[model samples]
Target: MLFEKPLTLEDIKKEPFIIEHIKWDAGPKELMEPSIVPSCDGFIKKEPLKGYIFYIDTMGDKPVLSLMRHTEAGFAETLAQLDDMPDELLKEAIDESKGKGCFGMYPINEKIKALLKKELGAG
Candidate 1:
């Protein structure tokens, strides 16, 4: 089933690792694995999904890394891209997160796309 609604940070925050039905082009829509750690062969760090991933588009006025994954500790460690990052770098992270080896990236809702594009000034 294709879920027309895209999940939000609030939704994720409410329930971590909650399976969400997302549109899949190859076949029927599939559920996205909460936090698939490729390095561990799709091993999830936490048993229950509590914290959700956050994509940092900008910090203050500057646009930092756009699609990098960040959890609770993960965010604190990275400090929300305090260091300048290249736009291309985010692609690699995104690919790795949504690759065949992993559960796949979370689907961004249409509203999210619009909001992000507006915030980022339209791609």
Candidate 2:
């Protein structure tokens, strides 16, 4: 389905299922350069990286897992609608993605697996 207006972070926050299942706190980040004239800061500095942000787009009849790229402004580009993936394929993808790092991969794959299981009635 098509949304009359673009979806926002507020829209994502309103979904109870997503809030309960998905890990919204973590995502890709980049290590910032250390200060040349630093004291004794042992902790590494990191900043949010530009990457895909997963959210449920409810414009459709059923809530669908949607992919969007976060921008300096906000969620901007709609990459894909991932609602129709076959159950087997989704399962395989989830399994294969386990224990993987965040670079060029879904950092929230477990959350996605949970959402998919709920959507596919597999739970």
Candidate number with greatest TM-score: 2
Q: 1-123 in candidate 2: lDDT tens per residue?
A: 234454454454454443444334343322112223334774553343344455444455654455555543333466456656444544454355554434343333565656644653434
Model 2 Cα displacement at 22 (Å)? 21
The residue ranges of model 2 lying beyond 4 angstroms of the native Cα positions read: 1-43, 53-65, 72-80, 99-123
Quantify how close model 1 is to the true structure by its C-alpha RMSD in Å. 15.1
Report residue 113 deviation for candidate 2 (angstroms). 16
Which pairs clash in the backbone of model 1? 6-109, 16-49
Write the residue-wise lDDT of candidate 1 on 18-103 in tens digits: 32211112110122333345555655554322222224233345434323332334231221232244444534434434533222
**Collision count of model 2:** 0
Residue 10 accuracy (lDDT) in model 2: 48
Candidate 2 residue-wise lDDT at 111: 53
- Weakest 10 consecutive residues of candidate 1 by summed lDDT: 21-30
